[model samples]
Target: MDTRQRLRTSALVCAAAVGMLISGCSSGSSFSEASAPSGSSVASPPGAVSTEELKTYYAQRLSWRDCGVPGFQCATLRAPLDYAKPDGRSVDLAVARVKATGPGKRIGSLLVNPGGPGGSAVSYLQGYAGVGYPAPVRARYDMVAIDPRGVARSEPVECLDDKDMDSYTQTDQTPDDKPEVAKLSTAFKGFAAGCKSRSATVLPHVSTVDAARDMDILRGVLGDEKLSYVGASYGTFLGATYAELYPDRVGRLVLDGAMDPSLPARQVNRDQTAGFETAFKSFADDCVQRALCPLGTTSPEDAATRLKDFFAKTDAQPIPTGESRPLTESLATTGVIAAMYDAGAWPQLREALTQAMAGDGSGLLALSDSYYEREPDGTYTNLMYANAAVNCLDAPPAFTTPNEVDAAVADFEKASPVFGRGFAWASLNCAYWPAPATGSPHRIEAKGAAPILVVGTTRDPATPYKWAQSLADQLSSGTLLTYEGDGHTAYGRGSDCVDTAINTYLLEGTPPRANKRCT
Candidate 1:
């Protein structure tokens, strides 16, 4: 499994915490809003295509209709399949919005993305941001979301079918020998091949850069002179890419759980491994304090040792989960990692671990299923498929061969003794990608951009706090907002200070003071 896929929004994590097991909250849709007129030309940065060539695309109007959900309208926006070939084929992007409900003067649209590179931004809007955002913020700005190209509702990438995906997920990630390594490699290759065979046309175009460009077009279609946005996890990378591509068009952008674009693929995986370890320690600390702690009422280090022992036990003999599929080490590890994304889920994780340790693997298996967006019927959302597509296209593979991974094992192990080996091996999935990487690790400094807020959780598991610091330092107008707490992203996660600062920025165009720390 790709570790980067863990960079999903806290909304999903909170869903798991609240026992909305199968999938998150459902969204209602209805149509009653008029379409926003296409605005004047939005200039592209130097070296981009001339605005004249893209006039047709920028000027096209969106026809909004009820999206089967109350209070939400959906529309499709057409963008070039390949930007270089503007006159060639096109890809349709799904866009959704809830018009501002205001007692105050309406601000412009506030586009929200919940990471995943694959997460359904539209679903996020209707299910969370559109209704759950602070009433004051929602009362002013129209909440908008566009599922980036090759994401949900758009042309999503398809990989292995359900049965094959089950086998793939159960594959041993930490190889004990040559045969195990070969088996893992074959699974990776098969996943890539399946994507190639099923989604050949759109796989290569799902890079973050392409998604960023799509955001610009969406901005124009919505008649926003400058984009106001909230992007989490990988969405932060997407938002940063947008600021870099069109600095002057950026407005009131908040990149919570920010990622550093400068890190290579290997570094990203390794850092995420360390990040998981950090979060695990936090969980372990809390777990030991509970009288019913499954790992024993011992120190955090002892809990880690016990957890590793459990993994080894599962590796040797898979635990039956009541379902046809058994709980293997990979699934259990994924389950644990999923819980690390939000502290609210720690209780669920503790219970899952308790059950797994007691020979009942149902809880852990369910958590793993949730992480993969697996439906109770065995179908899966296209989240993982698009996740791999975007991640692989955004950066070169972390390792070209098994030997490289073997060589880096020590570093990975040092970074995360429990998860490092699996994360190190997971990075190899992109090595078998059919398309070459279209992007590389580089610094992004949107020099002429308006103030951008970068939020970080001190114990964030997916995107490390250090990454937010790095991203804040990198962006020319970036300001850092630190949440001295746990969870993936900070805003809308119960931190009054964090929400107030971000809300102030969005409403009044005033960013939080640099290095402001909130609890």
Candidate 2:
């Protein structure tokens, strides 16, 4: 993640107020009876305990109880809140799995993680991956997910309440004065303090590396000899870390919408800003040909200029939606960002922009809601909270202060006039984090791991294509699967080419030829 969805993808800003509908994750048909033996389930380590206290954790019996879905059973996974103190406190992680329905022999477990450092892997599996995965793949393997610590339902981290978040999200990110900057800084500090207060232990332990360790524990507990996994966006970082930490134990790992752990937080955020610009150009290229385009039927550059001007206008005079909340500059920019996540959202963006230009902000508010994941009940998910928690712990802040962001403004503006300013400011979200970053920008060369597949979309807004190439090049046995297209991720986004290659790898243990391009 950029270090916010520059750490998780933008939560739905406006529309999530109704109910956020993210694409992918189909609700599959009813699941069949469990085929795997329960006795084989992992249990606490027996005999003399070694120095590795984690071994004891890896051996615990995970009691599975049927959740809402037919074959999907929920279980609690316990891991040390602080890996450095493994003999100390434990955190109960939420895990869910839908056993494979097979005509072929069961092929162990396939763990799936959606992009958010904070995105609920359990929800991703139950909603999409469990039933939405390839039929052959589903038939041969069990689909599983776990909510990493500090994320949803896994000792979730809490920050601002609904009304406070409403105000926070509306706070002027593109501050024009010292007062605005102070207000933004205060909000950042306040959010960090809230996480520290509510999730003191969990907050410090939710880094990507920590999450990877949790995955290894989950892998052992699931009775899998080797870990087979699929992770997207920030999830890719988690998967890559796992492969690096436990190379020999890696079965088949797929990293879609890959993040380059090699880059600093600023570079990642800056690169993502550019990537979103790339996506915007793609959107503008398409929009200019459409009459509904609010930016008018003009060149991409021209379209971007007009859109920037629109943000300027909204910034000056917030657009009033039918609701009490009016669309502010930050919300408007986020609304624009939500649409850039997937090409399918372009039309909605165009409509939203048109409505905003028409002085009705409801459409744009909905788009912003999509970015924030604010539900109709006005309750927010732990997404943004955990996103910042994990992101801040993974790396240092992009800008140490508002002044630093100001100093870098020109560089960012040079990066993307439309998004640079907003992203530069967004990068500072972790600046006031209570805990210092535990990890730094580095390479994860999973030397002895089985072939790990890295999927890169040509114009991914969040995780850019270059990141996949970089990660593929860094990994000892990495294979790059290029989706020569637009959007955040390639898998199951109407791409038989991308899906087939990934499916073959998962089922047959065949990696796509290195640097293979799929259209």
Candidate 3:
């Protein structure tokens, strides 16, 4: 993803929040029953077990009990305390599932992850993916979700309190002077220190690779010889890592809104910045043709100029939104940027901008609130805090100092001429992290894995299409599936072609022909 896009994407809880969503998983060991088991249910480990043995492992251990998701059941599985040190202590991973609702045929369990790097996969299963997945596909495969360690219900990472998160989200992402810069740096340090102090032991184990390993253990517990998964956004990274680490264990896998791990933090950030520009241009093009465009501009550039001007004005003089605090530039920009993701949100953004420009700030404020997952009562979710903590630990900082970030920001602005600066500077957050990075960008090539489907949206703002291409190129068994549309994710967002292709692959263990494009 480009920098500006990454900033907006990541900023939406931190680009990491735009992960996938699945429904139907709870917290203990009783998943619903499947109609019939397929012969290839559990994948066979290299030269270790036969397919029949793997199937037996799954058939015998899958105890069905009612989970909170009415028809679903929850289960806990024990994994090694550390993959690197398999003989150490043990960590219990929370796994949930909804058995295929059919009496006809059953494939092994299909695992799904919504990509927060910290998003609760089990929650996704219980709430969305388990039930909402294409019905035909759901009828044939046991749907499952496992909340990775350091995520919700799986030894979650607690960085800051609600008040701390509120302050962190409202802190100026754009600094005007040395003191402001120091304040920004202090906020980063404080947030990082909070994670280190509150969730220290688990910090070292939250990397994408570690999460991938955890998934493998879940695969073993479920008696699936191979892992079948649908990962969105950051989950794509996780899925891809699994493919790389245990290629031979990969069953029908799909990665949506794929991220290219081979790219350095800065390049990924910049590319995402450009992506937002593309999405913005699409929004602006639609807005300008309308008679009521808030900007009253003829072109996207003019609309962007108007936005920058408004942001500057807000920075100089905050506008009261009928709340205790007034709207600032950062908040205003965040609100505007949030709308650029899905074109369906454009009209709402236009109305919000019009109201903001006309001296009323509630509209824009509301947008910001939604983007930050904040309620009208000034309460906040832990999404942002969790986002930052996970991101800071997953990758090292792109730059080491404010000056370096400033230079990068200038370059970003030159590239986007709109969102570059804001996003570029946002990248600096990791630079000020109190704890050193526990992970760095790495390439994942699931060499011996089955065909893995990698999905990309051509105009996706959060994770640009190029990322999918990059990831497909990097993975040994990667197959690129393109959605020629606009949106963050494609599966259930309304593309028959995208959905059909993925559903077919998920249900029948088929991969879309390599480099397939759909609209």
Candidate 4:
């Protein structure tokens, strides 16, 4: 609910990348999508604007150039506060793009989203997605990132001050009693209320659908005839929505760690709970086999039981890390959970866990700090706040009451005996959100769109592998590209088979087939 939790998934993407990014591909080149998004449908939100209204909202906007840096041009575009009233109030969206350094071939502009539904597309463009994308693709097209409305540097939605966020992040995730459950609920409510009071105007406009529409405007502003994009994690959902809403405008799209729009909110939460469990199992299996594993068990199941017991102990008595704050079960779990996103962090995770279980909590504490983007100096990024705001608004809260949470806990526990209970409650942050749901889960057919690549990892933590399969099946033009490996996302997570296949598609306009699988 507070900004910290809101950006949890997005921040985890970065924290786990402290080392991965060091070795990631960074040279860039570019090339660029087809028809409308034609999958399944959810009922349109009330006051849905017509295409003309949407177009008018985009066209009337003025852009002012600002110096983002040496190589990129930055501007802000105004879109209607509410799309249905095109002539009404407006909100500014920050946009950035580095023009292609073409001495090669001019393909087109390519928009890139680095997940986060809450992640800053502009930051992603400048930092990771833009500069680090493969060279051939970068050389051919201008690389761009748009910070979604209600996200960082775009009239952001604020939910907590630094102090309040600190408390919110340390709130007990595993409820041991009625009072603890109430505390958790209160934390969720307080976090939600902060957003309502601070960012009331635009909370309603931050849905995935709204972001998708905004992407279209960016396409028009960039002078691109169609939308060409690469979206990772939740960005996959935004990209799919764009394809569905403006199928005719979809040019070339690659959705990595795709979300299955057909799953209900609770189902989505449960499935993700299971995914973390699966990832943990993989971690445990590998951990026990390694010399450094501190939990010390021969089998993954035993290692998992050891972790659950450790969490239970932390809940009963949290361990101090010598900081002003101690390591609570919630923070500890979050730290471990964060590592599940990328296998590259497995070594660090092992070290962190060993230190924590041995009474030296600095390593696990540091991992949690990284995941929360809590800098060593104690300041925090707005990523978590935006992550929660967008997630809560795009869909209904996952649970209505503690009983509902309790009912789901058994299944969640079964899914990943170590992570299920905590994630089940983490999903509840939206239950107390102030914004009403403007979107519902629905399958995107993308029937008339060109072939779209849907990449998935077998052991992805945030967006599970099955969701990718389901999404591919749901989309009329969907092609499933499988990486039988570990990590939250594919594409550039270090695989020649995976990287070359996707690069070929982005560069040559040839999507791997629906059943394509790479080791």
Model 2 stretches astray by more than 4 angstroms = 1-51
TM-scores, all models, native as reference: 0.93, 0.90, 0.86, 0.90
lDDT, candidate 2, 1-519, per-residue tens: 021232133221110010011111112112111211122222212231232455577657787888988879998988888776788889999999888888798898999888677788887787678888889999999899999888888999888788988887887777778898788788778777877888786777788777887887777777776889998888888898888766777899999888899998889888887887898999999999987779989788999999989888888999999998999988888888878877777777898888889999988787777567677567888778877887888887778888898999889888788888777777777778888888889998888788999999998877889999999999999999999998887888888999999999999999988789999
By lDDT, the better pick of 3 and 4 is 4
Q: Write the per-residue lDDT of candidate 3 for residues 293-321, one digit (tens) a residue.
A: 99765888898788778888988888888
Total backbone collisions, model 2: 28
In candidate 1, position 424 carries an lDDT of 82
lDDT of 4 by residue, 430-489 (tens): 777788877778878977788899998898878889999998989899899999998878
Could you say which candidate leads in lDDT? Answer: 1
Lowest summed lDDT across 10 adjacent residues in model 3 is found at 18-27
Q: Model 1 over residues 5-61: C-alpha lDDT tens digits?
A: 332335553210100111110122221112111223223433356555666776777
Cand. 2 Cα-lDDT: 0.78
* Residue 380, candidate 3: C-alpha displacement in angstroms: 3.6
TM-score of 3: 0.86
Every candidate's lDDT: 0.82, 0.78, 0.71, 0.75
Candidate No. with top TM-score = 1
